[model samples]
Target: MTWNCRGVGSKKFERGLRFLIQERNPDVIGLLETRVNFARAGEIFQKLGFKTWVAVPGMGFSGGIWVAWRDEVGCFVEKENAQYVHLRFSGQGQKDWLATIAYVCPRDKEKQHFWDDMAQFAQITQEPWVLLGDLNDIMAENEKKGGAPCNSRRCELFAERVSNCNLLDLGASGNRFTWKGPLIPGYERVYERLDRGLCNPSWRCLFQNAVVKNLTRLSCSDHNPLLLCSNDSGYGFGPRPFRFEAMWLMHSEFDAMLKGCWKGEGGLKNRLMNLQPNLLQWNKEVFQHIQNRKRKLLARIDGIQRKISNFNRPSWALINLEADLQKELEEVLHQEEVLWYQKSRGQWVNDGDRNTKFYHIRTVSRRRRNKIVMLRDVNGDWVEDQVALRQMAKDFYVDLYSEFHEETVQEKSLFDNCTVSFPSLQTEELCSMNREITKEEIKDAIFSIGAFKAPGEDGFPAVFFQRKWHIVGEDVVKYVFHLWQDLEDLKEINNTLLVLIPKVDRPDSLKQMRPLDYVM
Candidate 1:
């Protein structure tokens, strides 16, 4: 849980903190604007049952930050400043993660320095990281209700910092505004979402079912506490679904991997099922390792650039190393861009525009916006639990399509009083539509489709076949030939997934969504 405690030294603040701790029972707690010294901070944390704690002491009761965790959560302070405290945490049998608790200064000049510090930290940190607390700024005008409009310059700087760090806001629940200012007689009161949770993609992947909730204000403090909850147990039972990433096509081994898996015997459907296991194994061995190498290369490049910037007379070897690393980084970045671009499903942006950052932002924005946080059921009751949300969607769709009772239709004789309006198709013309599909026809059909279009349940986009046509072309042609020869074969390959897209800004009912069919 993260909160801007105002001043933890105060008895009222301390009591509120204890109440929050008891109510939420967070494994880790981050406090901003603590307004206390190290000794007092340590004593307070110890009394509150935190086995490990760290603090960036307040200066003359101005600003301070504290991060405390339970004994089971292993972590150590990596860095700290007047504005923030960073910790590197490692749990047994779990991935390591970095957590930063920050309290940005309200002054504009000081906030610039805060952004610079965050950017530098983002460059060096290797683990999945979460940065949260009172940022003292809003990303958009809507984030502030009655306050003066947010400065565009500050919003731009904050957004740039977040983008550079590849961080996505973990979107909040409960109150839209986390902080409120005092009300005046003639002027409107100020309310802004200054407190939030931001994390990198790696952290999101590691905690796929995690959510940050902004709890309602229960104390005198202006800022509400934000809680990060992981609902891992609620995830549906099954093996993780297979997803085809465009980045995989950039790997040298990708074509060979497909060719090797496609040679199995049996009908097309069985062959695809056979290929699934091999592809999954290849992903584990190839894709995962390449991601690790890419991260290391980025870290090394960042370190070398920092050295060059600091030194007027950099070593010749250092310069050459930087150049070599940059060349490699470019290739990896292109592949990464392809991956994000495919996921974005955007048409306005094009390749060679060096707009990977834009694509990344768009992709992240779509995911966050599409995510269902809360839903109002038919009874007008709100459902927040993940499992309940899924069940609600399931029931809605089932009831929508299910036939409770059958309707009787009046039978009419076609020859009773009908007059011919148009001539029927000749036998030859009818047979033409059923003519055999050729290998060339199959190739033309595959190539005609957009390469980057969304993949179906089979997890293979059109690009996969187009790029490796020489290797997989024969098998594809044979499959199409079988379908043309036997109409029954079409049924085997006709399965599709129904993707729901919102038709309104904020859809609250099934009727407000449009379903698109995605055939494999």
Candidate 2:
């Protein structure tokens, strides 16, 4: 669930990694070379839901480390040697465990002292640990991309120390390299497989199903960050629900209707629950049917319309009846001759005038008469037919309504969280105690709450601590005001009397505001 990603002191890369952490919402994030002051690092990690600890002495560009875990997690930071952070996790009715993250300098002449310091750390812990970071050594040439020979001294030293300490190098699969240099004009991509994760046997079992993928280089950093996924066997696949634009769906029109409903004003949770069932049932039984019917009807109506338009030809019977229909034909023919004369020469002389005028009148008369005769015999509908047009418009809107608003059963169940565990990793009681917790307690609880896995809904936002409120006992708000005169973050947003009491028999003093004035 956690790994040491050498951010390489790139602010842009760090920002991208921070974005990923926020998106994934991980419980623990082990980062190195954060290139930030300890206070800034703490603030950044805290916003992302982790209680962070940074290495001291501000080595500037030389090197630094940061370990961040959820507030409820228990941990200890040993800064004496090699800067190892030991983390522990404790849960009700379950055995407790520990994990660790550190950045060990490569075993080269320049950085031999740091590697030596790690040996002492390994000796002291004497417990299961998962150590991860950039060790600056290649285990084998095959592990690197375009790699030459391995750094034998550093590699042999790291391997011997880890093996002697009973640590297993949990090698990455599906990847041959972890770090890559920037693009050069003429040279091939320079790469080094430096970052790694090594764990004790105990940690191995927990990470047996874990995956670490080399993600794309987010910024200008040479190293592509690794994505660590654990307890995610069923994370990717599921019956995803149909999602509608809630903001669009609940427009001003739906606002009044929603407000009038009991569930609408309660909160987002209540409104969703109210809409879920109706959508689910509609989606299950009617959505697809409506879509198919709409398509078919549209196709059929289009065909009928096209046929009416394309089959507009006068029949022989109509032409033969022209003599019997001489009066009607003459009237239409005269109107056409008048139109042609006016459009051609602004004169209404018609066939009795010039030869050119007569020819024009004959041509126009034949075309006009042909159209009128076709309508009278084969397909002559000149009026708008308002009723039929209106029916078609109504059907189109009705079909659109079904296609958009209908919800499905499967989608409803997805939001409902049918298979979810409760109480979070840190139970309510523990979480209450951890709020505004001491640095020592923060360190001690790192692993329990960090490694303790649960779906997001189980977790409570850190915002709860930004304001003081009642959780367990009555008159708690009064105590908060009495103790902290200026608790800025812990401000009261709202307050309500759980039960109203009859006041006629009470003293007038009880009705008057006193210390209660500030709270109200």
Candidate maximizing lDDT: 1
Top candidate on TM-score is 1
- 1-520 in candidate 2: lDDT tens per residue? 3334444345665577677776567666766555555556766666566655545422545445666666565555534234455566565343455666555554366356655555565677645556666666666545555434455675666677677666666554323466775556665666876776666655555434444444445554556555555444432223444332222221223333333332324332344446555544544553323335445545554554555556678555544444334543343344444434433333235353443345353433332221100001013222223344335434544553575755557768797977876855657777786455343443333323322121122121121211112221122233344334554334333432221132322112212112211111
For the record, the alpha-carbon RMSD of candidate 2 to the native fold, in angstroms, is 36.8
In angstroms, give how far residue 368 of model 1 lies from its true place. Answer: 7.4
Cα TM-score of candidate 1: 0.64
Cα RMSD (Å) between model 1 and the true structure?
A: 9.5
| lDDT by residue (tens digit), candidate 1, 68-156 | 89998788898888888888878767888988888888887777788788888778776788888888888876677774656888777
lDDT score of residue 185 within candidate 2: 64
